[model samples]
Target: MPAGEVRLVFCNAPDRDCAERIARALVEQGLAACANLLPDCLSIYAWQGQVEHAHETPMLIKTTAVRLPEVIGLIQALHPYEVPEIIALPVTEGLPAYLQWVRGQTLPLDKSA
Candidate 1:
């Protein structure tokens, strides 16, 4: 796979359960190749002109640029937050085989398969 073909999406959920739910949906729907839920994280951000802090579960989603839009849409539809955090970063370099696997996994499922 070439550079920029794969994306690493960053998202934060209210808790482990929420993160798991989102991760499962993304991978099951083929919008993401994998979703890694990290340990509890402390997030301090500005919202509505106020600074807020929360313990959250950080998620790392692996997918392709082609599936990014659908991935974002699904997260929004399932996320509880009024405005969820979803960021996609281009994969500039990685093990060739791993990147290829990511691409293949995210491809739209073939109905005839």
Candidate 2:
């Protein structure tokens, strides 16, 4: 895979359990190479013309660009929020081996070998 093919996906879950569930499913299903559940996050945003605040668990997901669509779809299906925070940023640079590992890890089961 090329450098720009890797993506860093950011998603926030309602809590630690939800974060863990999403992360595990992503990795186990080969949709993501890794998902790091970060410390509690305080999110303040406007919704339905009203301001809201909540504690969330931020997740940093690693996967190839090719798998981004599946990653997003799965998150949407499992996420509790009506509109979950799912964003992907291109990884322009990183350790070569690590990037390769991510690409390999996210490949479909048949293609991984």
Encode model 1's per-residue lDDT on 2-82: one tens digit a residue.
433999999999999999999999999989999999999899999999999999999999999988989999999999999
lDDT of 1: 0.94
Model 2's TM-score against the true structure: 0.93
- TM per candidate comes to 0.92, 0.93
**Per-residue lDDT of candidate 2, residues 1-113 (tens digit):** 45339999999999999999999999999889999999998999999999999999999999988889899999999999999999999998999999989988987666555
Looking at model 2, residue 67 earns an lDDT score of 88
- For model 2 the local lDDT of residue 88 reads 96
Shift in Å, residue 65, candidate 1: 0.4
